[model samples]
Target: MSHNAASEPDHHPVSTAENWWVFRGPADLPPPPSWRGIAGPAGTPVAQEYLLSPEDVAVVNTALHLRRPLLVTGRPGTGKSSLAHAVAKDLGLGEVLRWPVNSRSTLEDALCRYDAVGRLREVSLERERRSPRGASGRLRYRSRGRHSDIGDFLRLGPLGTALAARDRPRVLLIDELDKADIDLPNDLLVVLEEAQFEIPELARLPEDQQNVEVLVTGSRERVPVSRGTVTCDNFPVVVMTSNGERDFPPAFLRRCVRLDLQDPGEEKLRDIVRLHLGDDALAEAEDLVQDFLQRAATQTLATDQLLAAVHLRITGADLSRDQLINTVMRRLDEAFPA
Candidate 1:
């Protein structure tokens, strides 16, 4: 439905099946209320709780306002990644840029690659073949070293995308930074501090296009990033997550706003299940989910296992309880063998 500020009250709350829509401002065009605390689909509304506390919200808000990176630490399945998406949605920004970290990851892995050398070779070969001597001229072709046009192929990486965003700040999710190598985080400190990165390839390009975009993430890998060395002058919002594996360098910790995540309570879980699964299966799924969680708590079952059981319990054939349990167990066993 269209919202006009002139027609509607300054704050009019409309209830829908999923969530409430709040409108504010002028008649011609009214800006939708920020979805900071609200939960639902990207633009559509859905009923979901902000499981984070007020203090946590303040920390996040401060990070966003100042464009500083906010580091979030918590156990697995605590919705750390989801927060990035939420921030983008709340600000009416589009999709988020996600950078998944791994052990072998490097700065080059996250930045653009220049293929100028390859292109130059192809062009030289083509010219030789079309010369007066035809294929025979190919033998006379000089072996001039390939020139690198770093600017042309210097495409933006996840971090680059975040820093270069001009229209609106884009949400960036750097998942599992701990897995990355030592130099990766150190290399990132330069861009994170300056809010600008120079692509060696692009440096030769026109001044306007020489800069690269950037956003970075880190985990409990404990790589050292020295202080007073690099600072984010542009201030892009940064979010980091840790699985409580190890402590980060003190210097890195001092620069960030950290927050912990708590497991969802029954109410919040119910809301999440309903939001994703629907109302009809909420009751049955909750029971199965709780049982799965109980088992998981004692062992080290992945979150996907619990979700699988819930799915089977709600959507599987109308079998006896024992049969259903057997099906779930079999699936879990296949997914995670002892």
Candidate 2:
């Protein structure tokens, strides 16, 4: 079914069995309504809630023992990224520190970013707000050697935050490393091996101002920095994901534990469906699962596409199940008629 405009959402939890082919749009747009493919619940499962294969479990444990990044390579929808969350959940680590890599990503950007311009502007404004000019037409701050703390201008990125001293290890997810600039993987070798990074701004601070509280990327919480350097008390568990976009340098590959995710089988797919949708929907939806498996043999179809198709199926769709499957399972290159 074709919808005129996206319908508004309700606050209640999405029931596995929502009535579909029913109107959700404006009063003018009635009956045989479009599918609500985008209407899933808001948040994803945490680390503890995720499912991991035994092979994946073995490789992840190896990386944990060796203290190396686990590099995950897979096709789209193969759970390459979710592996990080599963590991964090299983280990009871706090929120995963995620660094999403792209073409512009760099090692320095990952470690820390100092906003000098923003700092200069704020400092100038702060001086005026705090104290008025004296007879010499110069501002006089109250008993000041350094007017504002340098730590205020500095913030650590995800990598840097993971490296900061903490009671326990943080789980760091470096997502899509293959999408990063060519040198990024190689540049990561030192940080991965050393588990430490220095903030030059804090490093050069006067001895008296050496210890400062600074901001980190994800938590946005300030942590104490000593002598401008950060060293992990516990080495972080690192997971890096890739879509098989490109090859990594041999030296870079040598340092990382690799895990390659394959598409889930029929049994695993049914289990996944049961986990996400519900047992109520699984019986009828299993029919689509077989259809999806058939198409997946000839063309690439992500697990998510199957989920979306199933999500619509469980809803009381006016359209026949076969029609809905044919419409939703189109190849990536297949185009819909205008």
Best by TM-score: 2
The TM-score, computed over Cα atoms with residue i paired to residue i, of candidate 1 is 0.64
Query: Which lDDT tens digits does candidate 1 get at residues 1-338?
Result: 11111121122232332222123422232233322233434433431223455666887888877666677776666678777766665566656677888887777656434466765776676577446565644445444665333233335566765665554666677787767776666576656766655455444545554343322322111111122112222344567666666666767666667777766556656554554444655676666667655665554344434444554445443445566456653333245556
lDDT (0 to 1) per candidate: 0.54, 0.74
**Residue pair clashes in candidate 2:** 47-89, 48-89
Best by lDDT: 2
lDDT of 1 at 79: 74
Clash count in backbone of candidate 2: 2
Misplaced by over 4 Å in model 2 are: 1-48, 134-148, 318-323, 326-328, 333-338
lDDT of 2 by residue, 199-290 (tens): 88888878788899999875558889888888788888889999898999999999999999888888778776666666666787877889
Q: After TM-score superposition, what is the CA distance of residue 205 in candidate 2 from its true location, in Å? A: 2.0
For each candidate in turn, the TM-score is 0.64, 0.80
